[model samples]
Target: MRNKNSRNNREVMKRILGCIRPYWFLVLLSLLLAVITVVLTLYIPILTGQAVDLIVGKGDVNFTGLLAVIRNIAVAIAGTAVAQWFMNHINNKITYHIVQDLRTRTFHHLQVLPLSYIDAHPAGDLISRVITDIEQFSDGLLMGFTQLFTGVITIVGTILFMLSINLWITLVVVCLSPLSFFIAGFISKKTFTMFKKQSETRGELTGLTDEMLGNLKVVQAFGHQEKAQEEFEEINSRLAEYSLKATFFSSITNPATRFMYAAIYAGVTIAGCFTVIGGGLTIGQLTSFLSYTNQYTKPFNEITGVITELQNSLASAARVFQLLDEPALLKDVPGAPALENVQGKVSLNQVYFSYLPEVRLIEDFNLDVCPGQRIAIVGPTGCGKTTVINLLMRFYDVTGGSISVDGCDIREVTRESLRTNYGMVLQETWLKSGTIRENIAYGSPDASEEEIIQAAREAHAHSFIMRMPDGYDTVIGEDGGSLSQGQKQLLCIARVMLNLPPMLILDEATSSIDTMTEIRIQKAFAKMMKGRTSFIVAHRLSTIRESDVILVMKDGHIIEQGTHESLLEKGGFYAELYNSQFAPAG
Candidate 1:
């Protein structure tokens, strides 16, 4: 398992390195500066060695010469700092561009992915992949890697310099480095486990937050505040524990690395003293060699940590790529055509559909309509009413048979074009946090002001909209909370009206509205459906009693279909349903 993890770590590092592949020249340039800095910085220690030799040899101590050496060392250090700063700046800029490129590509890829993929993934989980996961590349990969490379180079260069001074001592110091590296590697690997757990847990927390906010009304109505808070606290406590563990794991790296440095430094110092006392090395050379050792060991700790850092980075990148790599299950043929200027004549021929395999929801359903026809689907709860709309909209493709618009297979037309001549008002109206006008205009963004007002007026929303503080410009709170349920539904209706699709879908559009409001909406819908094909799904059967045709469904199959009056005469499911309502009316 350890070996497999290590191998995975190496592979991830390789993939992350690919992000920098396009900017290989920039990386090389930065490394050139870093190497130059390391080289110049090493010169200062060597200069110190010469000064030490001058003093130890009892040579005439020229104060001016000593001062000049000090100044030169200072100047060299300053230059090295500048070079290192430039390296960081350039690399950071390049990483930003790379991350930006990756984000753009990932988001674009998501746009083309099938609804199934999104359905399976929580929005927040997917969002974390795009935003949080990619952020790790910047946080852990780009900077971490460059430092690792620089450290390796500096360490290797310093070792060679030490070897030039004394090969035997150089070998001894080099031997200690493996121990330092191994300990650092081990610690970092542990840290990687903590990071993985923390990242996954954080994603779940975010998903939970998103899910709860989406159903805020249910939460409030059920008075789940204390329960929700308790649950959140429990998750938060778990997250806190994992986060602290990750922090501690990473925290050990620095102090442990410093301990390694201390050990190496002590050994080198003791070894140098013996060499000096035996006249095997000059004081200056030993001092300079010690400086090189410090430089070498400092970077060794950094380089050894690359495996752990790369593991986390690669895991993040892989998640992002996983999202991007998904194939769009819903796609038009290569030569797919536009739906064309449609007549709104829709047909479902032998439609069979299911949300899940075991739960068949629509079975061999058939429907046909001439242009400008009004049809309503009325059924008991879970009788596949919404599933019919799902089929019509091609939200999920049919498992059997096909739906057509104007006699052309919907599958053969581009989804965008096929959906252009259709409009929907869902039971749950989704309003953006925008002005009333903006929410309505979303249907036809290019609509003129006059058109917007006309649609709002048609839907009976203009009067209430005008009563708001800013009228059309009133900024809606989250999900249109500022407005009443009836007002929000009316706004959605106006939005659908603004689009003026020849075929319309009202999926319980007025189910949440009062009877008076429903009557007003029904009047507006009557006008809207006059010269267009429309399908209405409603539990309030009165909402569709005047429809040209009514279809009754049960357990995924249609049991009855005829004119409303004809169905009432037949005394089947539709008649029973109608009588159940009217029996209570009188």
Candidate 2:
């Protein structure tokens, strides 16, 4: 496990560096500034030592020479400050730009990922990876750019300056520095595992919170507040535990390195004092060597801190890269023709599918429909009713057999073209945070104002929309903020009404609307389905009575098929289902 983790860490770092490659020029500029800053900073200690030498005795001091040395020191300090500022500015630019690029690529990759991948992952977890994890990575990378380069340069510069003063003292400082590195490295190796666990727990907590919040009403109605709280607390406790462990390990690194460095500083001091007494070094030179010792050790402290942060960053980066590495949807057939002028005809020949390979949910399903047919599919819950729509929409391709439209296999056509010809509205309504007009025009972005209003009127939503303060232009929040469920469903219906695609799939689309509104919408649907291929999946038996063909499914098989009246006469699964819904109350 340790070796595997080390390998993954190396790979994550390589990819991060690859992201920085595009901004090499800015990174180069920052490095140059870091060098200048370190060099000028180290030069200041030399000038201070010279001023110390001029102060030979209280009254024997060379005031003019000391003043000149102090002036030079001030100039060096000012130069260091200027270089540090520009370096920081450049680092900020590079860090944020890399962050922006990573976010963009991650989001874009999401768009192409197969629906199966999305269905298997929680929205909250994916969101945490994209937003929270990337932000953590950003903080780490920024710290790295700001300190890593400067710390390295400072360490090297201080060593060179000390060696020039006295080789023996420099060797002592250098020899003792490895202790700090060993301590820091030992602590950091343990932090990565803890931090990774913390990140995972955080994502789980986010997923649970989002799931609860998104369905807070259901949770409250079911009196599940306590249960939900318990689940949340469990995940939250794990997150806290992991976070504490990770933080504890990383936090100790600074002080631990500081202790080792203190020993190195004392050793250097003792060694320098003997050299000064033996006349091997002047008092001013000894002072300068002590200053170099402090300088050399400071970078070790800072670099250790940087290493801790980088471990956290790499953990987050590993999660992010894991997302990016998911297999994208298979590319559309090259040079495939766009599905245009679609006839309403569609055929499914021996189609098979399952959410899990070991457990089949749909198998060997076959169906054929002529142009201008209204097909209503009905079954008990989990009877593969919605799964049929998924296959038809190509959200999940059939594992075997094939589905074709107008005698052309769906897989041979561009997905954009295939999907564009079908308009779908599910039981759950979704509305973006926008004006009612914009929401209605979502399916048809270029739809004219008149067309949008006409679609809303047809869906029986115009009256309620006009009652809002802004009427058609009334702005709403995500998922139709403050709107009634029926109102949101009406808006979704209006969207499809605007597009009027050649094929339509209504999966319990009117479940949320009142009976009165549904009756009127049914009339509109009748008109819309007049010349289009329509597939209606509904539990309300009465709603599908007008369908040309009614399919009753059981365990992924079509057990009965016919018009509602004919199916009722058969007294089969279809009759039993219809009677169960509309049978006289006992």
Candidate 3:
């Protein structure tokens, strides 16, 4: 498993670096600046030694030579600072743009992804991956490259400078430096799993918080506050534990590397003293060599720190790549023809489907509806009513057999064109944060205000909407938080009415509205259904009494189908369901 994870991590790294391909010029510019900055910075220690050498003795200083060296050092320092600034600026620009592209790509992928994928995953988990995880990955890359390139170059440059002075001393420093590397490698190996686990737990925690906050009303309705809080605390505690463990291991690497460097420093200082006494190295060279030794070792510490951060970043990148790598809705069937002028004649011919391979949700389901017919589907909860809608909408493809519209197999048409012809109003109303008019006109963005108001009036939402201070222009809160449930449902209905698609699906759409309002909306729907094919999935039998054909489903099978009066007289499943709703209480 560890080997597999390492391979996967390497693959993710390749893809992550590929994000920078478009901005390679900027990256190269930033790197050039970084190298120049480090070169000038290393020049400072050499200048320090030169200034020391220019001062002959305690009070017999070569003032002229000292001033020249000082001036040169000052200029070098200023130039280095400027180069460093530009390097950081360009690096930041590259990092943010890469992440922005990634975020946009992820969102676009979501738009085209299969609905089944969305339904199977937690919304909060996906949100964390897109937002928090991607941000973390970006930060890591920024810091990683900044530390990595500068540290490596600094180490190599310092070693080369030392070699120009004393070969033995340079060799000693080189031999001891790997001690830090060895220790860091050992500690980092242990910390990798911890950091990866901690990242996973953090994502889970974000998911938990989102799920709870999103449904606070439901939690309160059943008085589930205590249970919810307990669950949160449990996950939070686990996250804290993993975080502490990962942090503890990573924190030790810096000091451990520093400790090894201290030992190397002490050895270098002692060796420099002996070399100075032997007349092989001068006091000035010895001083400069010590400074270079410190410079050389410091990069080891910084590189270890970068490694620690990169481990965590890699964990996050893994999650983001996993999402990106998901199959994209089967790709609209390679050059599929576009659906045009759909007449809404839909047929399900021996259709079969399953959410899971072992358990079928729909099988051998058959239905035929002529153009302009209103078909009602009534069934017990979880008896495949919604599954029928899912299949027709191509949210999930049929595993066996096929479904067609106007005799054209849906699979042969581009999803964009096929889905455009149907308007849906679901029980769970969805409204974006926008003005009332915008939400109603969501399906038809260019809809005129007059057309918008007409659709709202048809759905019986215009009066309530106009009561608000801004009327149709009033901005609704996220998901219509400020509005009542029925009002949100009304807005959804108005959205579909404005689109006026050739086919419509109402999945218990009026359940939230009051009886009188539902009656009004039903009348509006009847009027709207004059030339369009309609499918109604309703638990309330009264709403579908006038449907041309009523389908009774049980355990993925269409047990019966007929007109309301015919089903009632037949006294089967449909009649029993209709009678039970209006039946007198015991």
Candidate 4:
């Protein structure tokens, strides 16, 4: 269970390389400072070698010149340290901005993504990419970026100086370079798989957490708290195990690189001793070469670390790009115009649809509604009641047929225009964390304070809101947990009412509400429906007895259509369903 080694060629790398574009200047400046630092660092060893030679020759130490050289070398080394610090700070700024850009683009893209995309993906998996995957990419960038530049710069500069000083010793250190490379490549290849697993496990863990939080009530009701905890622990424990494996593989690089470094250092030390004894190279030069040899391997180790991270980061980058590349299969057509005030008339002509291409769910469905008509759609489960709302909302495109509102093919009109003119209250009510007034005014965010209260009054939510401690401003905790299900639905209804859209869709909005709440809401609903077109989907057929027209659906077809009394008189599907599910007030 390891990730495949991506042969993601230079082309893919070229695309993501734009992230480095904005930081080009910073990169150049860092490199310039790095060069100065490398030059000064190399000079220190040279100065020490000269100082040794001066002490050996002409005995008096050249007092004045020696002191000046000592001071200059010290200051140069200090300057190098300062420059390195500045380089690090600049790199941090550049990497932070890059991460910000990536994250910002991801969030913006998420907004444009169709609802179907979210429905298709697991919550935990998607969230993990945005949060965890991005974080990994950032860390990779920081390490990979800093090490790549500085590692090569320092190593090359150190080797050049060593070669100029004594080719024999330089060759000894250079020869060991390939060993570290091979080890790093092998270790990184092995470790990348573990890191990928860690990332996957993290996504699963986050998904479980989201699932538990979303269904906390059901879990608690079913007394599955311990079971959930166990499941979480099972997932968490696997994550921990994978993390440890990744860490273990990653740790191998340290010891492996250090060993390679030791071999190089020891070989150079032996070569230096030979030079000293044979007088082929001076004691001072040998000492300087020893210092140079030690510095060489440090960059290699840094490079190894960065290489490992680069592999992991590239993997994360690939995943992010995958999401960005996903086509919006459903979207507004070109040159679509926004609707101003939609007349409530709707028509579906020869419609055919299915989530799966080959398995058509609806075939040849056709219907028409006149302006301001109150229509009720009653059907058996899976008979397309929800699909009707879904199609009208344009959540998915119909394979065949066109839907029109006020004579404009909905596809020809912009999505915003179509949805803006409609107010939908779903069977399940969802409220964000906000005050009662805020929740009730969500559909019309710019509504006047008085307008919000008026809407709430019409929805029968104002009376209870007034009884709360903060009245209208009373906070409804997450998902309206602070209010009962019925109360939450009423707030949502108020929000819809506040919008005063010409068309309203109540798809089983009252199915979950208690009888008393339903009766009160129904009364308010009647007022809301006055002089406006409304489509209601109700399992309880008696609830729609007063509908202007009723359509009974079965197997995705409108099996019967007529007024409630006429349908009952005709004794068709509508009459049978109404009689079977509800017999009126007995």
Candidate 3 minimal-lDDT segment of 10 residues: 190-199
TM-score of every candidate: 0.93, 0.99, 0.98, 0.93
Q: Write the per-residue lDDT of candidate 2 for residues 334-443, one digit (tens) a residue.
A: 99999999987999999998999898888889999999899999999998999999999899999999999999999999999999999998998899999999999987
**Higher-lDDT candidate of 1 and 3:** 3
On TM-score, who's better, 1 or 2?
A: 2
lDDT of each: 0.83, 0.93, 0.89, 0.84
From the highest TM-score down, the ranking of the candidates is 2, 3, 4, 1
Residues 1-586, model 4: lDDT tens digits:
2333555524436656887887788888988987887889888988888777777776567767678779989898799889889988988898889889988888888878877798888888888888888888889888866677777887898989898888877887787689888988888877777777788888899999999999898999999999999999998999899888888888889789999899888888887898889988888888788888888888888888887777677767766777777775456788779987777899999999887677668889999999989999998899998898889988777789999999998899898888888889998899999888788877777889999989888888888889999998888788897688888888888899888889999998887678887788889888888888899999987679889999888888888899999999998887778778766676
- Pick out the ten consecutive residues of candidate 1 with the lowest summed lDDT: 303-312
For candidate 3, write residues 10-127 as lDDT tens digits: 8988998899899999988987998898899888888888887778478889989999999999999999999988988888898899999999999999888889889988888899
- Per-residue lDDT of candidate 1, residues 144-217 (tens digit): 64686688678878987898788878888888877766777778778777777777777778887888888788
- Please list the residue runs of candidate 1 whose C-alpha ends up more than 4 Å from where it truly belongs after superposition: 1-11, 55-59, 304-311
CA RMSD, predictions in order? 2.5, 1.0, 1.2, 2.6
Error of model 4, residue 561, in angstroms: 1.5
Which has the higher lDDT value, candidate number 1 or candidate number 4?
4
Pairs with steric clashes in candidate 1: none
Which structure is stronger by lDDT: 1 or 2?
A: 2
Instruction: Give the deviation of candidate 1 from the true structure as CA RMSD.
Output: 2.5
